[model samples]
Target: MNREELKALGLTDEQIDKVMAAHGKVVNSTKDKADKVEGLESQLEDYKTQLADRDTQLDDLSKQVKDNADLTAEIDRLKDENKTATADLQKKLETQAFDFALDKALTGAKVKNSKAIRGLLDMDTIKLDGETLKGLDDQLNGLKESDSYLFEQETEPTKPTIVNPGNPNGGTSTGDDDPFAAKLAKYN
Candidate 1:
């Protein structure tokens, strides 16, 4: 309990002094070690906070990347759709223009002589030769005759009488001879 009691209990003064010094040294060393540990713990806590912040930043970056990717994909899809729509509209416009050109050509041809009309309409048909050309000419002539007939029907209140000269048999003239041949011959 007391220093004197320990001394009286058979401890020597030298021994007690040595033990006290050693214990004091151990306590001091323990205190120093504890302070170092506390500093190390604080540093570890700081490192943990930094790691947590980095994780949050990484998560935010990942979300942004995902959003960007999604937006890019959507843009690509819309671009493709727009491209298809534009192509379709262009095709329709081209078809309408072609039809308008054909209609104008036919109307102009009708106003002029059948030969000149045939020449104008048959310009595209001239590219063919041999049987193909003949067939195309026949088809073009038929189209012209039909167009003329329709135009006459729309304009004339009375139908014109058909006069047959080529046919030996009593029949209306079919007008088989290419009426446009004379007009087209000038170009040839």
Candidate 2:
């Protein structure tokens, strides 16, 4: 139905004009509200994108923190292992020193011949009978140097005397009559 038909039925010209103007104003207001709602929706989408980015960044930082903690724990474990290894090595060194001291004492008791002692003795007073003897002497010396307090307790106050085991002239051999002297003479 047309506004003219409604006016013919009951309304006047002024009333019809007023009603049309009011309807136009309501339509314009609705269009303005719709525009505002669209702008707000676009802003909400932007905020959602920002929130997603922040969440991803937080996750990455959490992973990095966990990794750092793991590395720190590993370092602590390695340090503890190193400390245990050092203690074990020290104990082994002390044990070897005591055994060497006992072996030297036994060898001195068994060998009565003086020439043999002279022949075995090196310039440093360490026995050099064979590769095995030299190795034993080196091990003993290393232990002594590493543990000075133990070395002092092990070494006796009296110096050991060298005796000759061999006698070329079939006479009683002494430290002075050592036959191996000639072999070491050139090196000295």
Q: Pick the candidate with the highest lDDT.
A: 1
Per-residue accuracy of model 1 over 98-176 as CA lDDT, tens digit each = 4334433444334434445545454554432321333344655676577655332334323334455775655654545
Q: lDDT of each prediction vs. the true structure?
A: 0.54, 0.53
- Which pairs clash in the backbone of model 2? 114-163, 114-164, 114-165, 115-163, 115-164, 115-165, 116-165
- Which has the greatest TM-score? 1
The Cα RMSD of model 1 versus the native structure comes to 54.2
> Model 2 lDDT vs. the true structure?
0.53
**Model 1 Cα displacement at 84 (Å)?**
0.4
Model 1 CA deviation exceeding 4 Å by range: 1-67, 111-138, 145-148, 151-188
lDDT of 2 at 78: 55
